[model samples]
Target: MALDEAMLELAAGGSTLLRFYGWEPWCLSLGRHQTAPNRLLGSSPDDLRPGVDAVRRPTGGRSVFHGPEITYALACPARAWGGPRAVLQAVHRALAEGLRAVGVPLDTVQSADAEAGFAAARISAASCFRDPAPGELTARGRKLVGSAQCRRRGGVLQHGSILLEDKQHLGDLAGRDIEPRGSAPAGVSGRGPAIGLNELLDPVPDPRLIVERLTDHVARAFGSPAAAATSASAGIATSAALTRLATGYERVHRSGAWLWRRERPLPAA
Candidate 1:
C-alpha cells in the first residue's frame, strides 16, 4: 500500500505505473473511509484469527480479503486520463480487451445497468466484490474485476481485485442476502458474483500473460510508455521523495491503532 502511494506521488507527468501484487501472510484491508468491522462474516478476520493482520487502504472502497485474488494498482496522472471516471473506464476497457485476448470474455459494466442496485448494495455489502460498480470489468454478468479509485494531488490511484477459479467463500459476511451465484469458474460468498480467470481457462492462464496484455493495452490507450521497477529497495522507489512518502504511509498501515480505527493524531511535527 505504501509503495503504491509512493508511485502515485512520484509518477512522471505523462506516465502510469501499474503494480500487481499480493499480501504476505494474507490480511484484510479496509477502504480508507470504511469503519472497523463490528462483526465479520465467514472465516475469522484479524480480530478473531490470531496472527493474521489488517490494515486500511489509502484508497476508497469496501473491505476486501487479500487472499484468493490477484490485485492490481495503478498510479497515473489524472489529467492524462481525464479524471476519475475516465480513469476508471479507460483502465477497465483496456483490461477488458486484454482479458478477452486471453479468452476471459470480459466486459465493462455500463453505468445504466449498474445504477439500479448500486445504492442498496453499496450500503449493505461489506466486501468490494459484492457488486459491480459502473466501469468495472465483468464476465457474463458477474464481476471479473472489482476496482476502486481515489485521487491525490494530480494523480489517480485505483485498486482492484481479480478473483480466482473458485468461490471466495467469504464466510458469509454480515448484512447481505445470498442466493447461490449462477454458473461455474467463479462463485460468490455472501459477497457477490465474481469470476476468476482459472474458472474460464482450466489451470488459469499464467497471470503474467494477463498482466503483460494489460500493460501493453493500458499504456497504449493512455499514450504512455511502460517501465518495470520490481521493488522499493531495487527501483526508483529508493529516491528520496518516494522513501519519504512511503515512510508515512507505512506508518499508517503498520499501526494497529490505525487499522482498527483507534488512532490518535501524531503531535504536530
Candidate 2:
C-alpha cells in the first residue's frame, strides 16, 4: 500500500515504476472504502492464518483473493500513456497477446454501460473470475483480469491481479457460498479453478518466461526498454520506508479511535 502511494507521488514527479509480487499462503485484500463489518462478523481475527489475512488497500476497488495469481504494479505519468483508459487497454492487449501465443484465446472486456463504467462492487457481481470490464481479459464473457488505479500528483499507479487459477478460495473471500463449475479456460486454470502453464503444456513454461514475455510486450507498448532488478540494495532501503509507513497506517486503520477522528466536531469551550 505504501509502495502504491509512494509510486503515485513519484510518478507525478515524472518517475516511472513497475513491480511484480506474490501472495504467500493466500490472502484476501479489501479496498480502502469496503466495509469489513459484514464480512468480519462470525469470523475470528485469529482465523486468518496461512491462507487467510485481510488488509485494506489504499486504492479504491473491491476485495481480491490472491494466491497463484500474477500481480503487477505500474506507476507512470498519465501524459506518457496518453490517459488511464488507453494505458489500461495497452497493457491488457499485451497480456492478451502473451496468452494467445500460448494457445489461450483472449478478448478484452466491454462494460454493459460503456459510457459509464461499472462500480467496484459490481465487478464482484459475479466473481472476479467471471466478471469483465473495459481493458479486462475474458473468455466466453467471464472475467479473467481485474485492475484498479490511484492518480496522484498528475501520475497514476495502476496495479492489478491476473488469475492463474479461477475458483480456489474466492467464495470464502467474498463471504459467498457459490461454487465454481466446469473447467477453466487455458493459461489460467488450477491456480484458482483455472489451470496454469504448470499443468497445460508438456514442459511447464517457467514463471520467468511469462514475466519476460509480458515485460517485452509492455516495453513495446510504452516504447521504452525494460530492465530487471533485485532488492539486494534498493530493497533494503525501501523495506525500511515501508515498515515505517505500515506502522503509521496500521495505527490509523486498526485503531477504532482513528476511525472516529472526523466524526466529532471540536468543542468550543
Candidate 3:
C-alpha cells in the first residue's frame, strides 16, 4: 500500500510507474470506503483465521484476497492517460494481448453487462473476483483479473489482482464459494464468469514470468520509452520522499483509526 502511494507521488511529479508485486502470509484488503464484512469482524475461529491480516487499500473497490495472485499498480498523470476510463480500457486491452501472447486467451467485460452481473450476484463486496466489473480481464467466461482506481493530484493510480491460482480459501473467508456455485446470474451478458491461469496453462507458469510479460505489454500501451524500462536505483531524494510518504500512509493503514473507521464512520469518506 505504501509503495503504491509513493508511485502516485511519482506520477504527480510527472513520472509514470508500473509495478508488480505480491503479499506475504496473504491478506484481505478492503476498499478505502468499504464496510468490512461481518464474518471478518467476528471472533469465531473460522471468521478470524490465524496468520491472515486485514488492511484497507488506498484505492476504492471491493475487498480482495491477495494470495496466489500477481498484483499490478500503474500510476500516471490523468492528462497523459486521457483520464480514468481511458487508462482502464488501455491497460485491460494490453493485458488481454499480453496474456494471449503467453497462450492464455482472455477477454474483457463491458460496463452495462458487468453492472448487471454485479447486481445479480448479490454477493458480499468482500469478494472482488466473485463479480468482476467492466474493463477487467476474463477468460473462458470467468474473471481472470480484478482492478480498481483512484484519481487525485492530477494523477491516477490503478491497481489490480491477476489470478494465478484458484483461491479456494476465499470461499471460507467469504462464507461462500469463491465463484458462485451454479449458472451465471440472470441478466449477466458475455463471459461473466471468473477463472485463473492455473486452469488454462499446461503447467502453471512462474509468477515472475507472468509479471515480465505483462509489464512489457503495459509499458507498450503507455508508450514508455525503452530507456525508462530499465530498473534503476532510486536517488537519495527520491528514496527520502518515498520513505516519508510510505511512513505516513503506513500509520493510517495499520491503525485502528483507519481499519475500523467504518465502525465509527469517518466524516472524510
Q: Which candidate is the best by lDDT?
A: 3
Ranking, lDDT, top scorer first = 3, 1, 2
TM for candidate 3 is 0.77
Error of 3 at 1 (Å): 0.9
Error of 2 at 73 (Å): 0.8
Candidate 1 least-lDDT 10 residues: 176-185
lDDT tens digits, residue span 146-168, model 3: 88877777878888888887563
Models 1 onward score TM values of 0.77, 0.69, 0.77
Return the lDDT, model 3, position 203. 84
State the TM-score for model 1. 0.77
Query: Which tens-of-lDDT digit does each residue in 54-103 have in candidate 1?
Result: 66777766766665566777788888767766777787777778777778
Winner of 2 and 3 under TM-score: 3
User: Model 3 lDDT vs. the true structure?
Assistant: 0.66
For model 2, residues 18-41, the per-residue Cα lDDT tens digits are 656666646566655544533432
| Count of backbone collisions in candidate 3 | 5
